[model samples]
Target: MNDTTPDSLIPYDEIVQEALRAVVGRVLGQVEDAGGVLPGAHHFYITFKTGAPGVSVPPELRARFPDEMTIVLQNKFWDLAVREEDFTVSLSFNQMPSKLVIPFSAITAFVDPAVDFGLQFQAVEEDEDDLASAENDSANGASERDVASRITSSEDGSNVVSVDFGKKK
Candidate 1:
Protein backbone atom coordinates (compact mmCIF):
# COMPACT_ATOMS: atom_id res chain seq x y z
CA MET A 1 0.00 0.00 0.00
CA ASN A 2 1.20 3.47 -0.84
CA ASP A 3 0.59 6.53 1.33
CA THR A 4 -0.80 9.56 -0.41
CA THR A 5 -1.46 12.96 1.13
CA PRO A 6 -2.80 15.95 -0.74
CA ASP A 7 -1.43 19.43 -0.27
CA SER A 8 -3.71 21.99 1.31
CA LEU A 9 -5.53 24.42 -0.93
CA ILE A 10 -6.95 26.41 1.94
CA PRO A 11 -4.83 28.45 4.30
CA TYR A 12 -5.64 26.60 7.51
CA ASP A 13 -3.08 28.42 9.58
CA GLU A 14 -4.52 31.79 8.70
CA ILE A 15 -8.04 30.56 9.22
CA VAL A 16 -7.28 29.11 12.62
CA GLN A 17 -5.50 32.31 13.61
CA GLU A 18 -8.53 34.30 12.58
CA ALA A 19 -10.83 32.09 14.60
CA LEU A 20 -8.55 32.29 17.61
CA ARG A 21 -8.46 36.05 17.39
CA ALA A 22 -12.24 36.08 17.26
CA VAL A 23 -12.13 34.33 20.58
CA VAL A 24 -10.27 37.35 21.89
CA GLY A 25 -12.82 39.64 20.30
CA ARG A 26 -15.73 37.68 21.69
CA VAL A 27 -14.21 37.56 25.16
CA LEU A 28 -13.54 41.29 25.14
CA GLY A 29 -16.97 41.94 23.68
CA GLN A 30 -18.52 40.01 26.51
CA VAL A 31 -16.66 42.09 29.04
CA GLU A 32 -17.69 45.23 27.26
CA ASP A 33 -21.27 44.05 27.13
CA ALA A 34 -21.15 43.38 30.84
CA GLY A 35 -19.78 46.84 31.65
CA GLY A 36 -16.13 45.80 32.04
CA VAL A 37 -16.54 43.37 34.90
CA LEU A 38 -14.46 40.38 33.86
CA PRO A 39 -16.03 37.06 34.77
CA GLY A 40 -14.07 35.35 37.55
CA ALA A 41 -10.34 35.16 36.86
CA HIS A 42 -10.84 35.57 33.16
CA HIS A 43 -8.43 38.37 32.47
CA PHE A 44 -6.24 38.26 29.36
CA TYR A 45 -2.65 38.95 28.42
CA ILE A 46 -2.62 39.72 24.72
CA THR A 47 0.67 39.98 22.83
CA PHE A 48 1.00 41.38 19.34
CA LYS A 49 3.45 42.71 16.79
CA THR A 50 3.82 46.45 17.28
CA GLY A 51 4.42 47.37 13.66
CA ALA A 52 1.73 45.22 12.09
CA PRO A 53 -0.80 46.92 9.88
CA GLY A 54 -4.08 47.97 11.55
CA VAL A 55 -2.32 48.40 14.86
CA SER A 56 -3.17 51.91 16.03
CA VAL A 57 -0.91 52.65 18.94
CA PRO A 58 0.25 56.05 20.11
CA PRO A 59 3.63 57.28 18.93
CA GLU A 60 4.92 57.16 22.48
CA LEU A 61 3.76 53.59 22.88
CA ARG A 62 5.21 52.64 19.52
CA ALA A 63 8.49 54.16 20.62
CA ARG A 64 8.33 52.25 23.86
CA PHE A 65 7.35 48.92 22.29
CA PRO A 66 8.98 48.87 18.89
CA ASP A 67 8.81 45.12 18.28
CA GLU A 68 6.17 43.30 20.28
CA MET A 69 4.06 44.08 23.34
CA THR A 70 1.99 42.23 25.87
CA ILE A 71 -0.96 43.97 27.50
CA VAL A 72 -2.81 42.87 30.59
CA LEU A 73 -6.58 43.15 30.38
CA GLN A 74 -7.53 43.00 34.00
CA ASN A 75 -9.32 45.21 36.50
CA LYS A 76 -7.90 48.50 35.21
CA PHE A 77 -8.86 48.36 31.55
CA TRP A 78 -11.79 50.38 30.20
CA ASP A 79 -13.66 51.46 27.07
CA LEU A 80 -13.33 48.19 25.15
CA ALA A 81 -14.98 48.10 21.76
CA VAL A 82 -14.98 45.04 19.50
CA ARG A 83 -15.61 45.12 15.79
CA GLU A 84 -15.55 42.48 13.07
CA GLU A 85 -11.83 42.65 12.39
CA ASP A 86 -10.37 44.44 15.40
CA PHE A 87 -10.87 45.79 18.89
CA THR A 88 -9.89 48.88 20.87
CA VAL A 89 -9.37 49.41 24.56
CA SER A 90 -8.13 51.98 27.05
CA LEU A 91 -5.42 51.13 29.54
CA SER A 92 -3.23 53.04 31.97
CA PHE A 93 0.51 53.12 32.32
CA ASN A 94 2.39 55.23 34.83
CA GLN A 95 -0.94 56.93 35.64
CA MET A 96 -1.23 58.00 32.03
CA PRO A 97 -4.12 56.79 29.88
CA SER A 98 -3.51 55.26 26.46
CA LYS A 99 -5.79 53.82 23.83
CA LEU A 100 -4.80 50.92 21.56
CA VAL A 101 -6.60 49.55 18.55
CA ILE A 102 -5.37 46.16 17.40
CA PRO A 103 -6.56 44.11 14.51
CA PHE A 104 -7.02 40.36 14.96
CA SER A 105 -4.37 39.60 12.36
CA ALA A 106 -1.73 41.37 14.43
CA ILE A 107 -2.22 39.27 17.55
CA THR A 108 0.41 36.60 18.21
CA ALA A 109 -0.56 35.23 21.58
CA PHE A 110 -3.38 35.30 24.10
CA VAL A 111 -3.05 33.94 27.59
CA ASP A 112 -5.09 33.75 30.76
CA PRO A 113 -2.39 32.96 33.24
CA ALA A 114 -4.85 32.73 36.09
CA VAL A 115 -6.27 29.51 34.61
CA ASP A 116 -3.12 28.51 32.76
CA PHE A 117 -4.89 28.73 29.45
CA GLY A 118 -3.11 30.11 26.42
CA LEU A 119 -3.36 30.31 22.65
CA GLN A 120 -0.53 31.12 20.26
CA PHE A 121 -0.98 31.98 16.62
CA GLN A 122 1.46 32.34 13.77
CA ALA A 123 2.44 35.93 13.04
CA VAL A 124 1.36 37.09 9.62
CA GLU A 125 3.98 36.84 6.91
CA GLU A 126 6.17 39.94 6.58
CA ASP A 127 4.74 41.19 9.90
CA GLU A 128 7.27 39.18 11.86
CA ASP A 129 10.13 40.44 9.72
CA ASP A 130 8.77 43.96 9.97
CA LEU A 131 8.74 43.73 13.75
CA ALA A 132 12.37 42.66 13.79
CA SER A 133 13.31 45.45 11.42
CA ALA A 134 11.33 47.94 13.48
CA GLU A 135 13.23 46.95 16.59
CA ASN A 136 16.56 47.34 14.81
CA ASP A 137 15.52 50.70 13.44
CA SER A 138 14.36 51.92 16.85
CA ALA A 139 17.55 50.77 18.48
CA ASN A 140 19.58 52.80 16.02
CA GLY A 141 17.39 55.90 16.16
CA ALA A 142 16.36 56.05 19.81
CA SER A 143 18.23 56.38 23.10
CA GLU A 144 19.58 53.39 24.95
CA ARG A 145 16.93 53.78 27.62
CA ASP A 146 14.22 53.68 24.98
CA VAL A 147 15.62 50.51 23.45
CA ALA A 148 16.11 48.87 26.82
CA SER A 149 12.57 49.63 27.91
CA ARG A 150 11.09 47.91 24.86
CA ILE A 151 12.86 44.60 25.19
CA THR A 152 10.77 41.64 26.36
CA SER A 153 12.17 38.14 26.67
CA SER A 154 9.73 35.50 25.57
CA GLU A 155 9.40 33.08 28.47
CA ASP A 156 7.22 30.80 26.37
CA GLY A 157 9.72 29.87 23.73
CA SER A 158 7.21 28.16 21.42
CA ASN A 159 6.69 30.12 18.23
CA VAL A 160 3.30 30.49 16.49
CA VAL A 161 1.19 27.37 15.92
CA SER A 162 0.86 26.20 12.36
CA VAL A 163 -2.09 24.10 11.15
CA ASP A 164 -2.37 22.05 7.98
CA PHE A 165 -5.72 21.09 6.52
CA GLY A 166 -4.53 18.72 3.85
CA LYS A 167 -5.89 15.20 3.88
CA LYS A 168 -4.80 11.78 2.53
CA LYS A 169 -6.84 9.95 -0.04
Candidate 2:
Protein backbone atom coordinates (compact mmCIF):
# COMPACT_ATOMS: atom_id res chain seq x y z
CA MET A 1 0.00 0.00 0.00
CA ASN A 2 1.72 3.18 -1.16
CA ASP A 3 0.31 6.06 0.89
CA THR A 4 2.12 8.47 -1.40
CA THR A 5 -0.43 8.00 -4.15
CA PRO A 6 -4.00 8.73 -3.04
CA ASP A 7 -7.11 8.05 -5.11
CA SER A 8 -9.57 10.85 -5.70
CA LEU A 9 -13.25 11.03 -6.48
CA ILE A 10 -12.67 13.57 -9.20
CA PRO A 11 -11.81 12.29 -12.66
CA TYR A 12 -8.45 14.01 -12.66
CA ASP A 13 -7.19 11.88 -15.50
CA GLU A 14 -10.01 12.88 -17.86
CA ILE A 15 -9.75 16.54 -16.87
CA VAL A 16 -6.00 16.66 -17.45
CA GLN A 17 -6.32 14.82 -20.74
CA GLU A 18 -8.80 17.33 -22.11
CA ALA A 19 -6.66 20.24 -20.93
CA LEU A 20 -3.52 18.90 -22.54
CA ARG A 21 -5.34 18.28 -25.80
CA ALA A 22 -6.35 21.92 -25.69
CA VAL A 23 -2.71 22.92 -25.78
CA VAL A 24 -2.39 21.44 -29.25
CA GLY A 25 -5.52 23.22 -30.36
CA ARG A 26 -4.32 26.55 -29.01
CA VAL A 27 -0.95 26.26 -30.72
CA LEU A 28 -2.53 25.48 -34.06
CA GLY A 29 -4.97 28.31 -33.55
CA GLN A 30 -2.01 30.61 -33.05
CA VAL A 31 -0.48 29.47 -36.32
CA GLU A 32 -3.77 30.00 -38.08
CA ASP A 33 -3.77 33.52 -36.72
CA ALA A 34 -0.31 34.17 -38.11
CA GLY A 35 -1.42 33.90 -41.75
CA GLY A 36 -1.15 30.10 -41.87
CA VAL A 37 2.60 30.28 -41.84
CA LEU A 38 5.12 28.70 -39.53
CA PRO A 39 7.22 31.28 -37.68
CA GLY A 40 10.92 31.24 -38.51
CA ALA A 41 12.49 27.78 -38.37
CA HIS A 42 9.67 26.40 -36.34
CA HIS A 43 8.21 23.31 -37.93
CA PHE A 44 6.05 20.41 -36.80
CA TYR A 45 5.89 16.66 -36.91
CA ILE A 46 2.33 15.52 -36.20
CA THR A 47 1.51 11.85 -35.76
CA PHE A 48 -2.05 10.58 -35.72
CA LYS A 49 -4.00 7.38 -36.10
CA THR A 50 -5.01 6.88 -39.73
CA GLY A 51 -8.10 4.78 -39.03
CA ALA A 52 -9.50 6.96 -36.27
CA PRO A 53 -12.96 8.24 -37.08
CA GLY A 54 -13.27 11.74 -38.59
CA VAL A 55 -9.84 11.24 -40.11
CA SER A 56 -9.84 11.87 -43.85
CA VAL A 57 -6.93 10.89 -46.04
CA PRO A 58 -6.19 9.77 -49.56
CA PRO A 59 -6.63 6.13 -50.45
CA GLU A 60 -2.88 5.72 -51.04
CA LEU A 61 -2.07 7.32 -47.71
CA ARG A 62 -4.54 5.18 -45.85
CA ALA A 63 -2.95 2.25 -47.59
CA ARG A 64 0.57 3.32 -46.75
CA PHE A 65 -0.20 4.24 -43.18
CA PRO A 66 -3.05 1.98 -42.21
CA ASP A 67 -2.62 2.64 -38.52
CA GLU A 68 -0.51 5.62 -37.42
CA MET A 69 1.18 8.12 -39.68
CA THR A 70 3.49 11.04 -39.10
CA ILE A 71 3.48 14.10 -41.31
CA VAL A 72 5.98 16.90 -41.54
CA LEU A 73 4.71 20.46 -41.68
CA GLN A 74 7.74 22.55 -42.44
CA ASN A 75 8.44 24.07 -45.83
CA LYS A 76 6.44 22.26 -48.45
CA PHE A 77 3.06 21.92 -46.80
CA TRP A 78 0.09 23.95 -48.00
CA ASP A 79 -3.59 24.48 -47.30
CA LEU A 80 -3.17 24.38 -43.55
CA ALA A 81 -6.68 24.52 -42.23
CA VAL A 82 -7.41 24.43 -38.50
CA ARG A 83 -10.82 23.89 -37.00
CA GLU A 84 -12.25 23.51 -33.51
CA GLU A 85 -11.79 19.75 -33.41
CA ASP A 86 -9.63 18.96 -36.38
CA PHE A 87 -7.07 20.29 -38.87
CA THR A 88 -6.44 19.66 -42.56
CA VAL A 89 -3.21 20.10 -44.46
CA SER A 90 -1.76 19.33 -47.86
CA LEU A 91 1.65 17.81 -48.28
CA SER A 92 3.58 15.95 -50.96
CA PHE A 93 4.69 12.41 -50.56
CA ASN A 94 6.94 10.71 -53.12
CA GLN A 95 6.32 13.71 -55.36
CA MET A 96 2.59 13.07 -55.11
CA PRO A 97 0.37 15.68 -53.48
CA SER A 98 -2.02 14.52 -50.77
CA LYS A 99 -4.39 16.07 -48.28
CA LEU A 100 -4.90 14.88 -44.73
CA VAL A 101 -7.72 15.67 -42.36
CA ILE A 102 -7.11 14.51 -38.81
CA PRO A 103 -9.02 15.15 -35.64
CA PHE A 104 -7.00 16.06 -32.56
CA SER A 105 -8.52 13.10 -30.80
CA ALA A 106 -6.54 10.86 -33.13
CA ILE A 107 -3.21 12.57 -32.60
CA THR A 108 -0.73 10.53 -30.63
CA ALA A 109 2.16 12.95 -30.79
CA PHE A 110 3.23 16.43 -31.83
CA VAL A 111 6.82 17.54 -32.04
CA ASP A 112 8.72 20.66 -33.01
CA PRO A 113 12.24 19.52 -33.49
CA ALA A 114 13.45 23.00 -34.27
CA VAL A 115 12.57 24.13 -30.75
CA ASP A 116 13.23 20.72 -29.24
CA PHE A 117 9.72 20.72 -27.85
CA GLY A 118 7.30 17.82 -28.11
CA LEU A 119 4.10 16.38 -26.71
CA GLN A 120 3.19 12.75 -26.26
CA PHE A 121 -0.43 11.78 -25.66
CA GLN A 122 -2.41 8.70 -24.91
CA ALA A 123 -4.02 7.36 -28.08
CA VAL A 124 -7.76 6.93 -27.86
CA GLU A 125 -10.23 5.12 -30.06
CA GLU A 126 -13.04 6.71 -32.01
CA ASP A 127 -15.66 4.63 -30.20
CA GLU A 128 -16.10 5.04 -26.47
CA ASP A 129 -16.82 1.36 -25.90
CA ASP A 130 -13.82 0.31 -28.02
CA LEU A 131 -11.31 2.25 -25.97
CA ALA A 132 -9.39 -0.79 -24.84
CA SER A 133 -9.78 -2.80 -28.01
CA ALA A 134 -6.83 -3.11 -30.42
CA GLU A 135 -7.37 -3.57 -34.11
CA ASN A 136 -5.17 -5.90 -36.06
CA ASP A 137 -3.57 -3.09 -37.94
CA SER A 138 -2.12 -3.92 -41.33
CA ALA A 139 -0.19 -0.67 -41.56
CA ASN A 140 2.78 -2.04 -39.73
CA GLY A 141 1.45 -5.56 -39.74
CA ALA A 142 1.05 -5.34 -35.98
CA SER A 143 -1.11 -3.92 -33.24
CA GLU A 144 -0.10 -0.41 -32.33
CA ARG A 145 0.51 0.61 -28.77
CA ASP A 146 -1.96 2.96 -27.13
CA VAL A 147 0.78 5.22 -25.77
CA ALA A 148 2.88 7.62 -27.77
CA SER A 149 6.63 7.19 -27.66
CA ARG A 150 8.91 10.21 -27.37
CA ILE A 151 11.31 10.82 -30.20
CA THR A 152 14.96 11.41 -29.42
CA SER A 153 15.40 15.14 -28.82
CA SER A 154 17.45 17.22 -31.18
CA GLU A 155 20.90 18.62 -30.46
CA ASP A 156 19.39 21.86 -29.15
CA GLY A 157 16.87 20.04 -27.06
CA SER A 158 14.38 20.51 -24.24
CA ASN A 159 11.81 18.44 -22.38
CA VAL A 160 8.64 17.10 -24.02
CA VAL A 161 5.33 17.57 -22.25
CA SER A 162 3.92 14.06 -22.26
CA VAL A 163 0.64 12.93 -20.66
CA ASP A 164 -0.22 9.48 -19.43
CA PHE A 165 -3.85 8.92 -18.45
CA GLY A 166 -3.11 5.50 -16.89
CA LYS A 167 -5.91 3.95 -18.91
CA LYS A 168 -3.77 1.36 -20.70
CA LYS A 169 -5.55 -1.98 -20.83
Candidate 3:
Protein backbone atom coordinates (compact mmCIF):
# COMPACT_ATOMS: atom_id res chain seq x y z
CA MET A 1 0.00 0.00 0.00
CA ASN A 2 2.90 2.41 -0.70
CA ASP A 3 1.29 5.36 -2.45
CA THR A 4 4.22 7.75 -2.37
CA THR A 5 6.27 8.36 -5.50
CA PRO A 6 9.82 7.18 -4.98
CA ASP A 7 12.64 9.36 -6.23
CA SER A 8 14.31 7.49 -9.04
CA LEU A 9 18.05 7.61 -9.63
CA ILE A 10 17.54 8.38 -13.28
CA PRO A 11 17.60 12.02 -14.30
CA TYR A 12 14.40 12.17 -16.30
CA ASP A 13 14.57 15.89 -16.91
CA GLU A 14 18.07 15.74 -18.35
CA ILE A 15 17.19 12.74 -20.51
CA VAL A 16 14.10 14.46 -21.85
CA GLN A 17 16.02 17.65 -22.45
CA GLU A 18 18.68 15.77 -24.37
CA ALA A 19 16.07 14.10 -26.55
CA LEU A 20 14.35 17.39 -27.27
CA ARG A 21 17.66 18.99 -28.22
CA ALA A 22 18.12 16.16 -30.71
CA VAL A 23 14.84 17.20 -32.28
CA VAL A 24 16.29 20.65 -32.82
CA GLY A 25 19.38 19.05 -34.31
CA ARG A 26 17.34 16.88 -36.65
CA VAL A 27 15.25 19.81 -37.84
CA LEU A 28 18.34 21.91 -38.41
CA GLY A 29 19.98 18.99 -40.17
CA GLN A 30 17.01 18.81 -42.51
CA VAL A 31 17.48 22.44 -43.30
CA GLU A 32 21.18 21.83 -43.88
CA ASP A 33 20.32 18.95 -46.20
CA ALA A 34 18.10 21.25 -48.17
CA GLY A 35 21.09 23.50 -48.83
CA GLY A 36 20.13 25.84 -45.97
CA VAL A 37 16.79 26.59 -47.51
CA LEU A 38 14.03 27.21 -45.00
CA PRO A 39 11.02 25.70 -46.73
CA GLY A 40 8.03 27.82 -47.69
CA ALA A 41 8.17 30.77 -45.35
CA HIS A 42 9.29 28.69 -42.43
CA HIS A 43 11.65 30.60 -40.17
CA PHE A 44 13.05 29.77 -36.78
CA TYR A 45 13.54 31.83 -33.66
CA ILE A 46 16.13 30.18 -31.45
CA THR A 47 16.87 31.31 -27.91
CA PHE A 48 20.05 30.05 -26.30
CA LYS A 49 22.39 30.55 -23.37
CA THR A 50 24.93 33.10 -24.39
CA GLY A 51 27.26 32.21 -21.56
CA ALA A 52 26.99 28.45 -21.88
CA PRO A 53 30.19 26.52 -22.27
CA GLY A 54 31.28 26.02 -25.90
CA VAL A 55 29.21 28.98 -27.05
CA SER A 56 31.17 31.44 -29.19
CA VAL A 57 30.18 34.92 -30.20
CA PRO A 58 31.74 38.30 -30.59
CA PRO A 59 32.81 40.06 -27.43
CA GLU A 60 30.67 43.08 -28.14
CA LEU A 61 27.58 40.97 -28.61
CA ARG A 62 28.30 39.09 -25.41
CA ALA A 63 28.70 42.36 -23.58
CA ARG A 64 25.37 43.44 -25.01
CA PHE A 65 23.55 40.23 -24.10
CA PRO A 66 25.52 39.15 -20.99
CA ASP A 67 23.19 36.21 -20.51
CA GLU A 68 20.65 34.78 -23.00
CA MET A 69 19.76 35.99 -26.45
CA THR A 70 17.49 35.01 -29.30
CA ILE A 71 18.31 34.99 -32.98
CA VAL A 72 16.07 34.74 -35.99
CA LEU A 73 17.02 32.50 -38.87
CA GLN A 74 15.12 34.00 -41.67
CA ASN A 75 15.82 35.95 -44.85
CA LYS A 76 19.16 37.41 -43.90
CA PHE A 77 21.25 34.79 -42.17
CA TRP A 78 24.02 32.93 -43.96
CA ASP A 79 26.70 30.30 -43.50
CA LEU A 80 24.52 27.83 -41.63
CA ALA A 81 26.87 25.10 -40.48
CA VAL A 82 25.69 22.28 -38.27
CA ARG A 83 28.07 19.98 -36.43
CA GLU A 84 27.72 17.17 -33.94
CA GLU A 85 28.18 19.33 -30.87
CA ASP A 86 27.20 22.70 -32.19
CA PHE A 87 26.03 24.93 -35.03
CA THR A 88 27.52 28.12 -36.45
CA VAL A 89 25.70 30.77 -38.42
CA SER A 90 26.29 34.26 -39.71
CA LEU A 91 23.79 36.93 -38.82
CA SER A 92 23.59 40.69 -38.87
CA PHE A 93 22.88 42.74 -35.78
CA ASN A 94 22.48 46.47 -35.97
CA GLN A 95 23.83 46.11 -39.51
CA MET A 96 27.01 44.52 -38.20
CA PRO A 97 27.68 41.03 -39.60
CA SER A 98 28.65 38.46 -37.03
CA LYS A 99 29.04 34.75 -36.58
CA LEU A 100 27.69 32.74 -33.66
CA VAL A 101 28.65 29.24 -32.62
CA ILE A 102 26.16 27.66 -30.29
CA PRO A 103 26.21 24.28 -28.62
CA PHE A 104 23.02 22.19 -28.58
CA SER A 105 23.15 22.13 -24.82
CA ALA A 106 22.82 25.88 -24.74
CA ILE A 107 19.54 26.17 -26.58
CA THR A 108 16.52 26.92 -24.38
CA ALA A 109 13.84 27.59 -26.95
CA PHE A 110 13.10 26.97 -30.60
CA VAL A 111 10.12 28.14 -32.60
CA ASP A 112 8.99 27.95 -36.19
CA PRO A 113 6.59 30.79 -36.77
CA ALA A 114 5.15 29.54 -40.04
CA VAL A 115 3.80 26.40 -38.39
CA ASP A 116 3.54 27.86 -34.90
CA PHE A 117 5.58 24.91 -33.67
CA GLY A 118 7.82 25.49 -30.71
CA LEU A 119 9.81 23.68 -28.05
CA GLN A 120 10.71 25.32 -24.80
CA PHE A 121 13.13 23.80 -22.33
CA GLN A 122 13.82 23.99 -18.66
CA ALA A 123 17.30 25.32 -19.23
CA VAL A 124 20.04 24.69 -16.74
CA GLU A 125 19.48 27.01 -13.80
CA GLU A 126 22.34 28.96 -12.36
CA ASP A 127 23.60 28.12 -8.90
CA GLU A 128 22.93 30.49 -6.06
CA ASP A 129 26.52 31.62 -6.02
CA ASP A 130 26.49 32.15 -9.74
CA LEU A 131 23.26 34.13 -9.47
CA ALA A 132 24.74 36.34 -6.78
CA SER A 133 27.84 36.92 -8.90
CA ALA A 134 25.74 37.74 -11.94
CA GLU A 135 23.64 40.16 -9.94
CA ASN A 136 26.76 41.90 -8.72
CA ASP A 137 28.18 42.13 -12.24
CA SER A 138 24.92 43.49 -13.62
CA ALA A 139 24.62 46.08 -10.97
CA ASN A 140 28.16 47.22 -11.59
CA GLY A 141 28.25 47.24 -15.41
CA ALA A 142 25.48 45.52 -17.38
CA SER A 143 23.76 47.67 -19.95
CA GLU A 144 20.13 48.19 -20.97
CA ARG A 145 20.33 45.57 -23.70
CA ASP A 146 21.56 42.99 -21.26
CA VAL A 147 18.79 43.77 -18.84
CA ALA A 148 16.21 43.70 -21.63
CA SER A 149 17.10 40.26 -22.99
CA ARG A 150 17.09 38.78 -19.49
CA ILE A 151 13.34 39.14 -19.35
CA THR A 152 11.60 35.75 -19.64
CA SER A 153 8.90 35.29 -22.25
CA SER A 154 6.48 32.86 -20.68
CA GLU A 155 3.36 34.99 -21.11
CA ASP A 156 4.12 36.81 -24.36
CA GLY A 157 1.26 35.18 -26.33
CA SER A 158 3.72 33.79 -28.82
CA ASN A 159 3.12 30.35 -30.31
CA VAL A 160 5.62 28.59 -28.07
CA VAL A 161 4.82 25.12 -26.78
CA SER A 162 6.30 24.52 -23.35
CA VAL A 163 5.82 21.50 -21.11
CA ASP A 164 6.36 21.69 -17.39
CA PHE A 165 5.80 18.69 -15.14
CA GLY A 166 6.35 20.37 -11.81
CA LYS A 167 4.83 18.77 -8.74
CA LYS A 168 1.87 20.42 -7.04
CA LYS A 169 2.04 21.20 -3.37
Query: Per-model C-alpha lDDT, please?
Result: 0.68, 0.69, 0.71
Model 2 lDDT tens row, 70-138: 776777777877888899888777788888888988887776766678876677664453332223232
What overall lDDT, based on C-alpha atoms, would model 2 receive against the true structure? 0.69
Regions of candidate 3 where Cα sits further than 4 Å from its true position: 1-4, 127-160, 165-169
Q: Which residue segments of model 2 deviate by more than 4 Å? A: 1-8, 126-157, 167-169
Question: What's the count of clashing pairs in each model shown?
Answer: 0, 0, 0
Residue 60 of model 1 has an lDDT of 83
Give the TM-score (vs. native) of candidate 1: 0.72
Please identify which of the two predictions, 1 or 3, would achieve the higher lDDT against the true structure. Answer: 3
Off by over 4 Å in 1: 1-6, 126-169
For every model shown, what is its TM-score relative to the native structure?
0.72, 0.75, 0.76
Quote the positional error of residue 159 for candidate 3 in Å.
7.3
Tell me, what's the RMSD of every candidate? 7.0, 6.3, 6.1
User: In what order do the candidates fall by TM-score, top score first?
Assistant: 3, 2, 1
